[model samples]
Target: MSQIVAAIDLRVVQLEKQGVTGMALANQMMGHMADLQMIYNTASDRDLRKLCQRFPGFGRYAMLMEEVSEQNQTMAMSGTHPYGDLPDLPEPLKTALVHVLRAAADLERDFQATADDGRGDNQGRLTTARWRWADDLEKLIYQFQSAELPLQTQALVQQIIKATAERIGRMG
Candidate 1:
């Protein structure tokens, strides 16, 4: 699990360096972080302590993941909107964003279902959905880059992409 997580983390870093940013990047990060959390949860106490000592960032990332999980729980309980104050994006971009968001929601639902089942029967479905979401998001980002949007819109898109990449860097 640790090796798998490390490989995924490295891939994400490489992708970010290549200017890939969006739901796909975020989803990949979240997936590996969850796997890391599972490792900690299932490890013996002494092993967990040793892991923390050997890899200081492990503990910090775990805490960060916990905080994020708690915040997500709170937001879900509060029934708050997942996306707030969406910008006035142009036609296909706006449509693409909507599709990506829906795919994200579906991925989350499948992940939770798999977790609840514990047998991981839904693993294939989750993987397929994740890849599809990633592909769609990649297309959207490419479209945003190629389309002739207003200066403000382009700047806003760039800001979003930069922020996401920075956040992922901090996490890794």
Candidate 2:
């Protein structure tokens, strides 16, 4: 399970790096984003930890992964960061931001759906997932506007924001 989780995470990192490097969006781009959220859910908990004594090998790596995950969470929360230093990009490249934003939204929805059902899931995981999505969305909006992003990118961002707002409106 951990190995599969690691593979998904690596794919997410690769996609992110590829986008930053101005790679063309391939057919698997959307599927890759969905897989990332799925992996996050899979590796995030350890109900079996309390059942067994330390399995030495798994214990060590789990601890290491937990720490790495914490650091990534921290970076995601710190609003003024990560992709801030990117150079001015063309319409095609900047449009890729939509994928990042959509992935965040998908993660939030996935977590919230589980959390709301109260199906013996960890509340902390759900709360943190939602917070991460909200914080990252805000940061993405700031970064998108701060840069001289192309008109097409601006339009895409606007559409996402509008759609999200409408969804929220319906809930109320």
State the TM-score for model 1: 0.40
Candidate 1: list runs displaced more than 4 Å: 1-87, 150-172
The residue-by-residue lDDT of candidate 1 on 43-136, one tens digit each, is 8878766665655445544555666677777876787735323456777786676566545544543454455557777778677767777688
**Residue pairs with backbone atoms closer than 3 Å in model 2 (clashes):** none
TM-score of each: 0.40, 0.37
Winning model by TM-score: 1
Backbone clash count, each prediction separately: 0, 0
Q: Give the TM-score of candidate 2.
A: 0.37
> Highest lDDT: which candidate?
1
